[model samples]
Target: MTTHVYFDGGTKNGTTRIDPPFDGDLYFQAGLFDKEERYLRTDEIQVVDGVTYTVFRFTA
Candidate 1:
């Protein structure tokens, strides 16, 4: 089965969006830009619907 994860930045949203089917790990740092650009590691992203969204994993 596939799992879904969501990261909510709330008011502090980033300009970049990474979408699904990604492999590897993601590293993000908050408050690095004047706007809100999340500094993500190369593995933290995937492409979906022509757009990019961040991927998160659930721990059981």
Candidate 2:
């Protein structure tokens, strides 16, 4: 099955939203973890309509 993954999808109303959804699973090392420790940093998976999305947030 094909998965729709979105990177740096951005936020909406303080919540992550899938903007310009991608066709497949795409990911990178950056914007995924912290510098000190390799900890997966992201928000809860949200289901909008019937689509489920795993949104990641970068730390400042």
Candidate 3:
């Protein structure tokens, strides 16, 4: 069995999409960029046709 993992893939405008492994901890990663916790935003999970992928976006 093989697991799927996606790094920083896909982007547009100022948002970067990342399909993290096993839907890993995103809050932690966002914390890294949001030291001051000013504005933390993420897009809705998107799935590609015929594939199971949890996609979301975060601004850096």
Candidate 1 residue-wise lDDT, 1-60, digit = tens? 112223434333333433454454543434655443343233355455555555442221
Question: Which 10 consecutive positions of candidate 3 have the poorest summed lDDT?
Answer: 1-10
Report the number of clashing residue pairs per model.
Answer: 8, 0, 0
Off by over 4 Å in 3: 1-23, 27-43
Q: Per lDDT, what order, best first? A: 1, 2, 3
Q: Which digits, one per residue and each the tens of the lDDT, describe model 3 over residues 1-60?
A: 112322233233233334434434342233344442122223434345544433333335
What is candidate 2's lDDT per residue for 1-60, written digit by digit as tens?
223332343332234433454433333333444233121235556565677767444332
Tell me which residue pairs clash in candidate 3. Answer: none
> If ranked by TM-score, best first, what sequence of candidates would result?
2, 1, 3
Task: State, as a TM-score between 0 and 1, how close model 3 is to the true structure.
Answer: 0.28
User: How much does each candidate deviate from the true structure in C-alpha RMSD?
Assistant: 8.8, 8.1, 7.6
lDDT of predicted model 2: 0.39
